[model samples]
Target: MSEFTVSGRYKNRDGYRAFETTIDAVNEDVAREHVLSQLGSRHGVKRTEIELEEVGE
Candidate 1:
């Protein structure tokens, strides 16, 4: 697994919220998906409301 830093923002009841998180995954694609899944499950965010700004390893 590789370490990735994912930074993005999502829409919520209030407004747009920024987020930055670390993830361990095989590649950038998986890392991105992991971020989306995490945000969705934890914060009730939808994929359509997410805007990923940067992803780096």
Candidate 2:
């Protein structure tokens, strides 16, 4: 697995909130999905509401 840095923003009750996190994945696509799923499950943010600004190794 490779480490990737993911940055994004999501829609919330208080408005938009930004986030940056790292994840281990085989590739950038999976890393992006992981971030989306994590934010969705953890903060109740939907896929549509989550905006992924960047994903890089």
What root-mean-square deviation over C-alphas does model 2 reach? Answer: 0.5
Tens-digit lDDT track for model 2 on 8-53?
8999999999999999999999999999999999998789999999
Q: In model 1, which runs have C-alpha deviations exceeding 4 angstroms?
A: none
Q: Taking the tens digit of each residue's C-alpha lDDT, what string does model 1 give over 1-57? A: 999999989999899999999999999999999999999999997899999999999
Whole-model lDDT values for every prediction: 0.95, 0.95
How many residue pairs clash per model? Answer: 0, 0
TM-scores of the models, in the order given: 0.95, 0.97
Name the TM-score of candidate 2. 0.97
